[model samples]
Target: MRDLSPPAPRARGALGVAAAVLMAAATLAAPAHAAAAPAGGTAEAAVTAPAPPMGFTNRDSTRCRAEFDEAYVKKIADILVAKGLKDAGYTYVNLDDCWARPARDDQGRLVPDPVRFPNGIKALADHVHAKGLKFGLLAGAGARTCDPAGFPGSLGHEAGDARQFADWGVDHLTYADCGGGGDAEQRYAAMSDALRATGRPVVLTVADQGANRSWEWDGDVAQVRRTTGAGTDGWGSVLARVKQNLPLAAHTGPGRWNDPDALHVGGYGMTETQYRTQFSLWSVMAAPLVIGSDLRKLDAVSAEILTNREVIAVDQDPRGKPGEVVASDAGRWVISKELADGSRAVALFNETNRPRHIATTAGAVGLPAASGYKARDLWTALEKGTSGTIAATVPAHGTVLLKVSADREWSQLPPLLDTTISGDAVARPGTTQRVASAVTNHGGAATGTVTLTLTGGDGWTAQPVTAASTDRLKAGATLGTEWDVTVPAGATGRHELTLTTKYRSRDGLTFTSAIPVPVLVGVTRPPAGESYLGDQAPLAATNGWGPVEKDLSNGESNAGDGSPITINGTVFAKGLGVNSPSSVEYYTAGRCTRVTAQVGLDDEAGTQGTVTFEIWADHQQVASIPKMTNADAARSLTADVSTAETVRLVVTDGGDGAAYDHADWADLKITCA
Candidate 1:
C-alpha cells in the first residue's frame, strides 16, 4: 500500500533548484512548440508567488460529456482568447477527470492518458501558459476515482502528485469527491500540506460534496470548497444550491469561497431567463463562476450572459464578502452584497413560476438613506435614480440585479419612478377595463410636465379618466391617474398595452420610460375540482433532476425515467414524482377546500437522501413535514386551502445538502366545494 503521510519539506532554495532541473529536462522532453520555463537565474528572485487567480473554469463541459482530450482543451483555450472571454475574467482552462491513466507508473507517479494527451502533461501546461492562461487539473482522493473508468487517484499519493503537478506547471488542483479512506480532514490536510511543500502557489479546490460541512474548516485547507452537490441544467438545481449556500455566507472571504458548482448558463436546457438568474445569483453569492458549456459552439445569448462585466465585477469584488439574504418570503428573495466602493449589489429574485413584484429599500440593502441613489440594472445596463425604494416586477425564475450608489448628482439624470397598474388588465372583447396607474417620483428634484400615455396597437383605445398630466411635481410625490382601456372587439389572445411616462429632469433632460401592461382578452380559468392532482396539468412545474413525473417517482434523470410513486415500500398509483428543491403549482381559483397527500423521501433514494415537504396555499405555508429521511416511512399530510387562488407543492433539501433528494407526493388529491 502507498503511504498517506505528508511530504517532507525541502530546503529554502530547493524550489529553485528543482525548477532549474525541470527546465533543463524540458529542452529535450517537450515538443518544439512548447515554451520552456524561465532560467533558474530568475527563479530565485521570487520571494513569494501568488496563488491561482480566482476566475472562471470550464469544468462542466468536460464532465458532462466524454470529450476530454488535449485537442478539446486547446480549442477551449483558443475560444477563450479569441472570443474575449479571457478579457472578461475567465482565465483558467481546467481539465476534469479521465485525463489520466488507470494506473500509476513503476515510480508510483500518475500518468497522463497517452492517447488523449500525446505530448504529455508538461507540454499541455506549457501550451496553456503560452496563451497567457493558467492550467488546472482534477484528481480524486480515494483508492479509485469517481469516474466510471476508475482512473488512478491521489489517495495515498498526494505528496508525489502535488510535486508532479507543480513540475508540470499546473496552477490549480481540484480534489474530486471520492476516495480518501480515513478521516476526510486528514486526507485533505495531507494534500494541502503537500501542495505548499512544493513552493508552487497552486490553488487548491476541495470538491468534497459538502459531506463534512467543509466550508467551516476549508478556509485553511483549500482555496475553494464545494458548498453543494453537482448541479444539473434545471432551475430547481440552481434553487437548491442557492438555498443551501445562502446561510454559509459568513464562512466565505478573500481567498476562501463557497462554490455552488459551475455555470449552467448556455447550451443547457434552461431558458435565457433562468440562465440570467443562475448567473446573477451566483455573482451575488460570491461563488466561483466556472463555465460549464462547450465554448467552441457557445451561442450569442450565452456569450452575452457570461460576459456581463457588471455582473462579473460583483463576483470578483475586492471585499470578497458574500451576499447575505436580506429578505425572503414565499419564494421571493433579496440578496445584498457590499462592494469595496461603498456600493451594494442587490439581487431581487423570483423563485416561483409566476411573475412576482419584489420590493426592497436602499437602506435595507446596506445603503444609507440619501437624497437620491443611483441604481443600475447590471443585466440590462440601465440606470435609474431612487430616493429609497429599490424594487421591480421580477419575471418567473428571473432576477433583477442592481448596483446602488449614493450619488449626489442623481438629479442630473432621469427621475426615478415607480409605475404600477392596480387592476388586472384582463378584459373581454369590446369591454373596457378600468385601472389606475400610479407614478411615484423618487428623485431629489421635482419633475416638469409629467405625462402618462397609454398606447397599444391599432384597435386598442385608452382614454384617461383622471388627470394624466401634472404641471409640476415635487420630489417624492406620486401622481395617480385612472384609465379606461378598451380591448379590441375581436381580440382573442394575450396583448399588451404600453404605458409610457414622459418627464423632464431637473437638468431639463427629457426622458421616457415604458412599462408593458398585459391584457388577457377573453381568457377563462379552469373550474376548482380536479381529480388526482397528478392527472391534471400544472400551471407551472420545475424539478431538480428532470421533468416532474405524474403517477411515478422521481427517477435518475429525464422525463418518464421513474417507476411507480413509491414511498418507503408502498407504491401509489396516482401522484406527482419530483426531485427535492422542486415545485409544482396549480391554479386553485379560490375554490379548493383542502390538499391531502402522503409525502416522503422516495424509496428510489435508497438510504441516502433527506427532504422536507411543504404545501403552500398562495403565499401561506398551509402544511409541512419538518424532516424526512430515507429511513422514515411515508407520512400522511393535509393542507387547508379553502381560500387560496393557487396551490403549490414544495420539496426542499432537509437543511443538509442537496444529494439524491428524490421525493414523492403520493395519492395527491385536492377537494373543492
Candidate 2:
C-alpha cells in the first residue's frame, strides 16, 4: 500500500487571518449534497463504483474506438504510468463519450465497436489496471450519448449504466452535459448519487457547460465540476480560462476543485514557457491536474515544466484557497493568493505584445510590510529581498510569480479613491450643457455621500452636474458625472473648469484627486490667410514640401503696370544642390509694356548661400538685384517682377555659401501689353 499523505501546507506570514476568515465563510456557504438531487423523486441509481487512486486515459470513443487497437491502449497506459501520475496522486484514466456504436446489442447493452477495441472494453480495463492505473468511461446526462446522429444515452437508465460500468471493472466515470439538459446541477447530482449507490468510490467528473453556477451548488456530490468550456492548446485559450477561474477559486476545496476543463500544457500550439505558465496557474488555483496532451510525444521541456515540485506545491497547498486579480490592464495582470502559511503568492503577468515592467508593493496589495519580506521567483529559482515591494520585468505574454512572507503583524489598508482628469472638455458656444467627468476609486472600501463642487470658471456660469445616484463608491470601481455650464454667446477663448470632491473618511484618512479640469471654450479656426490649393491649405505648405534642392534659381516676373507676369525657363538637367527658393521678390513697372516678376527655385540639396543677380528695366520698373540664398536651401523660390520705362540692375552677395550653379541663364523676359 502506498502512503498518500495529504499535500503539505504553505509557510505562514502576513494575510493569514483574513484569508482564513474568507475560507471559513466559503466552507459555510458550500451547498449540501441533498440539495444537488433532482426535485421530487429518486430514479434508479447507477451501480458504477467510485474511481480508484490511479490516473486514467480519456479518448473520444465514437470516432476512434473502431481503431482503438490493443497497441494503442497499451501505448496510452504506458505513457500514463511513465508520467508517474499514479505516484503523484492521480488515478482513473477516463475514456470520453462517443465510444459506443450507433445501436446496442440484442441484450440491450452498450457495445464497443468490435474493430476498434477488438478485445472489448473490459479487456481494455484489465490492461489499464495491470499497468497500475484505473480505467474510466464517459456518458451524457441527456437521454442519449452526445452522438447526435442517434446513439445510446443514460437518460432513463442512470442506474443500469452504473451497473454496466461496475461489471466492466470500470473505476470512474465522466458525465458530460449533452442534448441540452434541464438544470445541470440536478442532472450532475442524479448521476453522482446513482454511481455512489453502487457501493463504489468512483471519482465523478462533471461537465456543466460553464453555466451550472457550480460555485453556488457543488459539494461532496462532485469531486470536480467544469466551470468553463473545453480549452485549446494555445496560450490565449489557456490564459482566458485561467482568468475565468480567478473568481471561482473560493468554491474549490478538499475532495472538490474548480475544473477549468482539462490540461493542454504539452498539447499542440503552445510554447514551453506558455505551458509552464499554464501549469503554474492551475497548480496555484488547486485545480485538478488532468492531462490533455499526448505524453508519449512530449518534449523534455514540456515534461520538466509540468513536473516542477516547487511550483506544483503552490497549487496543491492544503489551504486550497484560490487567487484573485489585484489589478489588470492591457494584457497585464497582478494576482495574489492567500497561502496556508501566512504569506501570499503574487503573480504579475504581462500578456501584452511587448515586454513591460511590473511592480507591486505590500501597501499596494493592502498588506503590511512591518515584518520585512522575502520573494522567491518560482520560474527562475531565484530569491530576492522584498521588505516592502516586489518588482520585475515580465516578458511579452509572460509572468513573474513571487512568494511574499512578512515577519511582523500588519492590518489590511483601508480602501481609497483616486481621481484623474482624462483631458480638457470643449464646450460649444451659445448653449448651457453638462460635461461628464470620470472618477475612479482605488481605495479598499466604498465611499458614501460624495459631493463635487465647481470651484471657478472665468467668463462662464457654473451649473450643477448631476450623478445617476448617490451611493457608496467601492474600491476599484469607477463612476462618471457631468458638470452643467453655459458658454456665453460670442465667447471665443479658453477657460479652466475646476472641480473638487468632498467625502468623510471612515478610516480617518481623506483622499483627494490631484488633477484639475481644463476646458477650452469657443471653436479654434485657422488664421486669416488665402486658402492654399491643397486640401488642408496653408498648413500643407509647411508640411508637404520635401528637402530643399540646392544649385537652382527660379522666380516669377511681374509686368511694369503693377500687374503680375509669368517667367519661363527650361531645365537642362537635374542637380544635387538646393533647387528651390523660399521667398520671391516682386517688382513693378509703369507703362503699356509693364512687366512683373517673381523668382522661385527648387533646391534638392541644402548646399546654398546668397546668390547675386542683376536686373534692368525702364523707369516704371527698374533693374533689380538678387542676393545670396540663405543657409537653409530653398525648396521653392518665387520673385515678383515689374517693368518701367528705364531700369538698372545691381547684384551683391547676401553671405549665403553656394550659388545657383547648375543651369546658367542670362535673359529675363517680362510680359506687359
Instruction: Score every model by TM-score.
Output: 0.88, 0.52
Superposed by TM-score, candidate 1 places the C-alpha of residue 252 at a distance from the truth, in angstroms, of 0.3
Per-candidate Cα lDDT values, in order, are 0.78, 0.52
Candidate 2, 1-22: lDDT as tens digits: 1011221232222343344344
Off by over 4 Å in 2: 1-70, 83-86, 147-150, 363-370, 407-673
Which TM-score value belongs to model 1?
0.88
Ten residues in a row with the worst lDDT in model 2? 535-544
Q: In candidate 1, which residue pairs clash?
A: 142-179
**Candidate 1 least-lDDT 10 residues:** 43-52
lDDT of 1: 0.78
- In candidate 2, position 113 carries an lDDT of 66
Candidate 1 regions with alpha-carbon error over 4 angstroms: 1-58, 64-66, 425-433, 449-464, 468-472, 484-502, 508-530
